[model samples]
Target: MKEILVLYYSHRGSVRALAEQIAHGIHQVPGAVARVRTVPRVSTVCEAVADDIPAEGPPYVEERDLAECIGLALGSPTRFGNMAAPMKYFLDGLAGAWVNGTLVGKPACVFTSTASLHGGQESTLLSMMLPLMHHGMLIAGLPYTEPALNETRSGGTPYGASHVAGQEGSAALSADEIALAQAQGRLLAGYALKLAVAR
Candidate 1:
């Protein structure tokens, strides 16, 4: 079976919600499975430490996950138009994966959630792609052919999957957002399976 990693960081549970939806879509593809993981949070206070295993949710991701996964679905809430600090911190630790080309030629996609409609959803998505590009992964975005991209009133983008959590973070993912996220996962999984077979 081919595994696709669904890695994310969520505050207020919005990004995690999107991650779960993306995993749902990955499982739809035959021979593809989702390996869900999360990163430990960062803190301003010096020497803040976390347990080896999280109190809940998936296990903390290791560099090995990148090499093992045929595809990757990365998610983080928008923080000033970029992925949140913890997610970026996790990516920064991937220099070993970069030097070794552990993720080279793998399929990857990004997703994000924002507190406002104008909050940096697209920019956040783009920012997340930078590190993956350095690793030589093929970036997949939601194509316009997906009906949600054309019709979504909330969160959906050509860059990747997204959600608008509103200022109070009250809004659940709209239907279109859900559809687009699932479609992006399906697209990534299909590509990974095909590429793995070719290799």
Candidate 2:
């Protein structure tokens, strides 16, 4: 079985919810498994060391996960229309992987959560994609062919999967958001499976 890395830094659990849905979709495809991981929160004062293992959901991501996974799904919460600082800090530290081409030729997709309907969901997804693109990973996006892309009133986008968390960050994903996210995952896994053979 090949593993697809589902990596994210969720602030209010919304992005994490999307990551889980994406992983669920990856599982639907045979021969593709999800390796879910999360990045630690960053400190504004100075660099702080997080516990080796998180107290909650997924474990913190390691550089090796990028090297080992056949594909990637990167998710994050929107902070001023971009990915949160923690996710960006993690990506900024990947120069070694960039030089080694650890993620070259791999398939990747992006996801995000925003506090408002127009809270930069697409921009956040695009922000996360930039680093992956620099790493030479092929970006896989949600196509309009998906019915949910046409039907969603909440959070589906042609750029990627996304969710609207509302002000208190308590909004649950709508059915359309769920379907679109899962479809993105399956699409990414399909690309990974086919590309692995070519490589």
Candidate 3:
């Protein structure tokens, strides 16, 4: 099966919720599958280190995931209108992949979650794209053709999928938010399949 890497950093589970919904969409396409992975949290203390494998949820992402996947879906919680430090730290370590063009010509999509409805969701998605762009990947976003994008009152955008986690950091996704996220996954997987066939 062709795999699309679903990489995310989620603290309150909101971004991870969106990632699951997006993975569902990817599964809707035949011969396509989602490979969900998460990064370890960063710490300010110099002596702290994350375990080799996380205790819960998906396994920590490895370099092979990037080198093998046909496409990518990146997600993170909004951290002051940008991707969180852990996600940034992970991306910054891809210099060797950048030099080797490991991700070149691959299709990619971005997603984010925020505590408020106006909490820089789009900016976070855009920020994730910069590193993928540097890796020579093709960036895609939802088009207006998705009805949820027009009907969503909570957290869906043309730039990518998003969720309003509420001030209390709820992880429940709205109906429209779920629909849009699934739509994004389907779109991303579709692109990956098409490119694979073309090649």
Candidate 4:
């Protein structure tokens, strides 16, 4: 199987829901599988550390996952028009992988969730893309062809898939959000398959 890593950092489960939908879309491809993973939270104190295993959800991402996957689906909740600290912290530590070209030429797509309509969803997605681009990965985005992109009133972007979780941060995805996310996944997996063959 050509595994596409569906990696994310989610708080309050909104981003996680999008990741699951992206994985479902990846699975729609015959030879593709989603390797779901998450990153540990960054601690405020210098001495604070996360457990080796999380209490729930997907396993923490390893450098090996980057090397193994043929493609990537990156997701995070928005933080001040950017990706959350934990996800940024994880990406910042990947200097070794960056040098080794562990992710070079792989296809990548980003996703995000926000607290309000103007909560920086697109900026968050774009922020996630910078590091992937630095790694020499090809960035993919939703096209106008996806009906959801045109129809979504909640959260969807040509830059990536997104969701608007309301002020309390518990809103479920609208139908269009789900559709666009799945389409983004399928598009990413298709790119990965073709790119893998080309490589």
- Candidate 2 clash pair list: none
Tens digits of lDDT, candidate 4, 1-199 = 9999999999899999999999999999989999999998887662276678898999999999999999999999999999999999999999999999999999999999998999998888898999999999999999999988888899999999999999888748999999999999899999999999999
Q: Can you give the lDDT of residue 174 in candidate 2?
A: 94
Candidate 1, residues 25-94: lDDT per residue as tens digits? 9999999999999998888552266677998999999988888899999999999999999999999988
| Worst ten in a row by lDDT for model 3 | 43-52
- lDDT tens readout by residue for model 2, 3-86: 999999987789999999999999999999999999988885434556668988999999999999999999989999999999
User: Across residues 78-130, which tens digit of lDDT does each residue of candidate 3 receive?
Assistant: 99999999999999998889999999999999999999989999888888899
TM per candidate comes to 0.96, 0.96, 0.97, 0.97
**How close to the true structure is residue 38 of candidate 3, measured as C-alpha lDDT?**
98
Positional deviation of residue 154's Cα in model 2 after best superposition, in angstroms: 0.2
What are the runs in model 4 whose C-alpha is more than 4 Å off?
44-49
Question: How far in Å is the alpha carbon of 123 misplaced in model 4?
Answer: 1.2
Global lDDT for candidate 2?
0.92
